[model samples]
Target: MKMLPSKNLLMTLLTAWIALFTSSYFFYWQITFSSQFTHVFVGCLMLLLIGFVYVKNDFVEFEMFNLKEK
Candidate 1:
């Protein structure tokens, strides 16, 4: 039987996908929002925050599993 993916791996993959999508979306509208530096910066900051949370949650889950197995 095949095993399911770990939380960390899934979160990493999702974060990558989200980053790519956000970058492409911003790039696509670059011409229209060329002067919106604050918006772009805020968007990037939010994405980073989201990624950090996911990674942290994954780490916590991993730790919990390890503790349970011991």
Candidate 2:
């Protein structure tokens, strides 16, 4: 079967999206407990780490759902 052209791009984008969601979750929890800026700072750092992982690994593979062979 032929592979889709946008598959890898979609995977990368999904990874970024998930990272954003997770960071936001931390910020949300942080805001309830203490100062907004402090949590946001930590959240930003977490997001950056997530971004690094995606970039360094070059789109992590989900073997179960991936249609194409790596």
Candidate 3:
């Protein structure tokens, strides 16, 4: 009956992650290969983004399977 504590934060994080990867994928597929400097920059940026997201939100995910039928 209650909502998750960080649903919005997770949504925002997922949206940002999708957007960043989409742009990078577009560039990689449509344009030339990215340079090492670009790779380093994006990697650092992604790490910082993930770190910030991790620190700012309380989120966890898991999977469940029910072998017994109801």
**Cα lDDT listed for each candidate:** 0.92, 0.78, 0.74
Arrange candidates by lDDT, highest first: which order? 1, 2, 3
Q: Check candidate 3 and list the clashing pairs.
A: none
List model 3 lDDT by residue over 23-61, tens digit each.
988776644357667888899999999998876554332
Model 3 spans > 4 angstroms off: 1-34, 58-70
Better of 2 and 3 by TM-score: 2
Q: Which runs in model 2 stand beyond 4 Å of their true positions?
A: 1-34, 59-70
lDDT of 1 by residue, 1-70 (tens): 9999999999999999999999988887645565687779899999999999999999999999999999
The global Cα lDDT (0 to 1) of model 1 is 0.92
Q: Evaluated with lDDT, which candidate comes out highest?
A: 1
Pairs in clash, predicted candidate 1? none
As a whole number from 0 to 100, the lDDT of residue 62 in candidate 3 is: 18
User: For model 3, what is the alpha-carbon lDDT of residue 29?
Assistant: 65
Q: Candidate 2: RMSD over Cα atoms?
A: 12.9
Q: Give the TM-score of candidate 3.
A: 0.35
- The residue-by-residue lDDT of candidate 2 on 1-70, one tens digit each, is 9877698899999999999999888765634545767768899999999999987666455543465653
